[model samples]
Target: MIEETPQEVQVVEGVLLAHGIEPRTHWFEASTATALEAAAALGVDVGAIANSLVFRLDEEVIMIIASGAHRVDTHLLGEWLGGIVTRASADMVRRSTGQVVGGVSPVGHPERLRTLVDVSLGAYERVWVSAGHPHAVFPTTFEELLRLTGGTAALVARD
Candidate 1:
């Protein structure tokens, strides 16, 4: 287990606090690097785990908070956003969000990224999101997530 909160998680906590949210970050001894791992750790359904995915839409980086049970259809997303959506490289992800893949959060980026929250996430009353670290996560409702990230609600994933 981490002896202290990491700087990345602290930044996420700061963002949460700035938005009047009490950060209840959960740190795990084992790696919560995948949605399945996180869900197992939390004893929640996999669908309740929100996966923060970074994509390059043409020249701009965008974030999509998709449900763990779903996979994003990049072509569909591109049609909706009017750009070709491609999976971002690790370098691009780090440069854009200052967080690594499998640990990217909805907020706490160097700059506000255009974000979309998967509408299917609304099915869960409480959803767990990565708290800027592979071993950390936090709970939030779908509405709260949208408000926190200024994200639009959309069907970002394939059924």
Candidate 2:
């Protein structure tokens, strides 16, 4: 079994520590790029995985931390944000967050992008977030997530 944390994850750890949170990076042999994969790898519910989805609206980058169990309703999100939202491209994801799509963290970016935390994620006592790597994840709470990203809690996904 191989175990190595990616440099992006290390950067995320530094950001977490700087914010006074102890970071614990967990790497699995199985791929954790998707909610199903990550949940299976960690033996946790899919909803407990926070998917950091990036959307592009003109010049603005919107990072939506959505529950893995649901899909983000772009229409609703756009209405809530009062801006049109489009799926971000791979290049845009890397350029904006300094990380790839599957491993984008809620924090530790080249710049702070606008973030929204899904209210559904708050149902879980502990949630897992990407640690800047496809095979890396870290534990965090809903409140901590909001604090870290200064994200507004909203119904980002349709029920």
| lDDT score of residue 47 within candidate 1 | 96
Q: What C-alpha lDDT, on a 0 to 100 scale, does residue 92 get in candidate 1?
A: 92
Give candidate 2 regions above 4 Å deviation: 1-4
Evaluated at residue 34, the lDDT of candidate 2 is 97
The TM-scores of all predictions, comma-separated, are 0.98, 0.96
Q: Give candidates' CA RMSD values in order.
A: 0.7, 1.2
Candidate 1 — worst ten consecutive residues by lDDT sum?
Answer: 150-159
* lDDT (0 to 1) per candidate: 0.94, 0.91
lDDT for predicted candidate 2 compared with the true structure: 0.91
Task: Tell me the deviation in Å of residue 15 in model 1.
Answer: 0.5
| Cα lDDT of model 1 by residue, 97-147, tens digit | 999988999989999999999999999999999999999999999999999
What lDDT score is found at residue 37 in candidate 2?
A: 95
